[model samples]
Target: MADNDVSQLSASQQQALEQFTAVTAQETKDAIPLLRRSQWNVELAIAKLFDGEAADPVVEAAERAAAPAAARPQIPPPSPLPTPGPSLGAGSRNRVTISPAPRIVPQPTAVSRRPSLLISLLLFPFSLVWRLSNSFASLFYTLFPFLARFRTATSPPSRTQTTRRSQNPRDTAARFIRLFEEEYGTDTGLEFFEGGYAQALDLAKNELRFLLVVLQSDEHDDTASFNRETLINPEVVEFIKTQNIILWAGSVQDSEAYQVSAGLGCTKFPFAALISRAPSSTSNSQGMSVVSRIVGPTPPQTLVLKLTTAITTHSEALERIRATRAVHEAGRAILEQQNSAYELSLARDREITRARREAAERRAREEEFARAKAEEKVLLAKNRIAWRQWRATTIPKEEPVGKDTARVSIRLRNGKRVTRRFNGGASMEEVYAFVECLEYLDESATDEETPERPGGYAHEYGFKLVSPMPRQVYELRSEKDGSERTVKDCLWPTASLVVEVDDGEDNEEGEDN
Candidate 1:
């Protein structure tokens, strides 16, 4: 076969050819000829390789050897080997040995095949019954539309439309008025608002007016006479129109009107109730209060007098409530203004306090920086002086041996005497620096050291080093030749240095100057 032709074989075909050659103990050179003759079919080449008579006995022997020893059947005698079949050609006579056949493993069947078909057949009758029942129900509903409501009632209940129907008070009252006019004629002079009882109550509350609710039952014997004689009276009609009142009338025929009548607990027919706004402290439930109620028929003058008295009493009460509310509002305004002023003052105080604290912090930082600089300067000066002393360059040898240095004794204000030996050639500035260092060291040794002060000294007083024995004040001065004198030139071998603290006035003057 061509080299490219071998590459064209599928993976399974190549694997099967390798397994076939291994089982038959055949070389690729000899097997390829046989495989090509069979069109590279691995199973066909395998069958042809074992087709001779010699292979049949070897296969039978392997099968017998592989059987379980206990499962082998007992026989009277062993049968003789079968005679070889007649060979037609040299190729057919070629014997090829092979292993036993591979064991066959059963696979599980798919769930969607037979099982699904059976389930479908089992559920068919139930599905048909359900469809038939639904069809009959639909037919019944179509024939009697009203009966559909019963079926719907078994479902989850929803909000009814009655609430929306009753919301429009004006429409409901207007319809009732039309019905009343059709039944009894419109000759009565009593004017009524086209609204429900709730609307009338709300109007009376907002406008601070009275509400007149008239409930009439058509079955009552006195309803007609009461409306004609008392309600339609000129005096009653005039009072209702002239006074701060809203009249709302309804008949018992309407369901809404009957509900209102039942809620009011009215047993008598031709009932007239005067509703008004109660005092603020008193609870006006449902936004209405029954001020006066007249049951059955009564004279027009008596009804007018009762309405007038109730209106006067309630009007005076409402006026007092208005006055009280006005006073409370004024007090509340004043309190709010006072509280605003207090808050402003508190904010101002906080700002001032914050500024003072920040200033103090800034001063502390500046003092700390200055103290650090002073300490560095002192350390550098000490290093320079020690280097000069070690080099023996600043010592004056011209003076007498023992008198080469000056012994200066200083007396402090606290009655403490401090004496130290200094170089005779040292300048007066050195003498002052030594005194300042001594005072700083002394203050540090004490417990009452004030670190918040700007400088190392406790007091703000200036110091003047003087010689009391010579009666002369020592001052630093630059000569014309640009040369300054030292402590040795002023007070030779020994001198008494008295440190005098300046008074407040002298210190202030020195600062000013």
Candidate 2:
């Protein structure tokens, strides 16, 4: 088929095209229209190949008159019966038949012949009698089990009957294989599929191969010849191998095989069927369609032809199905990759959002802390100014001039000299206060402009006084307590005090003030 024409077809349809071409050996141009006519059914398309053609009325009449006998199917008379061979064993019911001459065997009719209702009614009495006799015999055997063995030995040779239930399908399969090898010899060159019926069907369906099912009846007249001549033929073996056909065979005596025969509706022994995946219109519930069936004995040539027809007809359709599966798998893989990428991107975005939120919270806390610290600094500066104003007013304005008074000389940090007098009872704190107000004394000359004392303020002076000659230092703020001793205790009557800047921890607030 042309590329564009094939592309327009669905996967199943494309598969049908390949199958039709392979089986019919038709050119692409011819196969496309033929497949379309069958609605893309491979089996239907192959069936059409053998269908009789429609003729014009005049042409049909002329042709019929010219070759009336030729138009009708030629079914030759039955061939002479083959001679009976030796029995398989003394007690064995199976009898082998020698190979007979090759002859054309007609395909089975689609409709089965059914007896009339009158005939069935007439036969009902005989069937009832037979059932009654069998039931009595079974009851007798059950009662006298030891006598049953003697009865079996005297009975006519017959195939063993079995129940319908599966009794170890694998074992049954293995047993069949072994029996087939023993009967036909291992050199037959044909190998049977090594599994149960269901397993064989699945293998054929999945691999797009043909499954050939052979059911043998040991008691049948033609089974021996069929196995010996037709199955062991070199041409048949080669065709099966080259075409990759899965062969599965079982004897009717086996429960598993009996079930398969009943299911396939086999009417004759030595039966064979070719099965494969086909269009839904022609397939069974399991999607398997029977391609060809050979009942009774068939020649090796006919078997090969039948198998070839089935293989070619279905090959292309399976190829298309495989292609479709591959495409679907690739699409699933791509979808998974896209989903993985999207999940990763989502995770990254979530991480970024969390980090930004945390950073914003940290910045808010830092800004709040700085604002509180600035407010605290303003309050401390106000308290220090109030304490300084209060201390300036409390200093003695005029020098004490009594007998108990003491005179002291002080040098300020500004390199200026100042004289001051204090009472004998005056504490050292009073002396320091006098020096602190010197700035006010020089600026105003009086205490009239002094500020009021402030509450709730603990103040520390930034400068300290020291006697330079002895190197004794006096701090404005006491380490132990706020109390101080009188200056007379250290500089009684006369003393020189030097004021230098204090560089202790108390200087922090003083510098800010």
The number of the candidate with the highest TM-score is 2
lDDT of 1 by residue, 1-513 (tens): 342254676787577668657655677655655564455776566556543212346644664787665664432121222333333242122211111111112122224444487787998999899999989988987899877544332322122212323334566688767776775678666568877676676777766677888887654556778877888888988889898578888765554555666666566777877776554324334444666667777889989887776665456545544544554566688899999999999999999999999999999999999999999767655554343232232222223346667787888656678777777777876666555444344334453533332233222225778888767777655454557668788766888988876565232211111
lDDT of 2 by residue, 3-67 (tens): 33778888888887886676557777667755654557776655555432232477445545865
lDDT for each candidate structure: 0.61, 0.67
- Give the TM-score comparing model 1 with the true structure, all chains together: 0.31
At residue 141, give the lDDT of candidate 1. 77
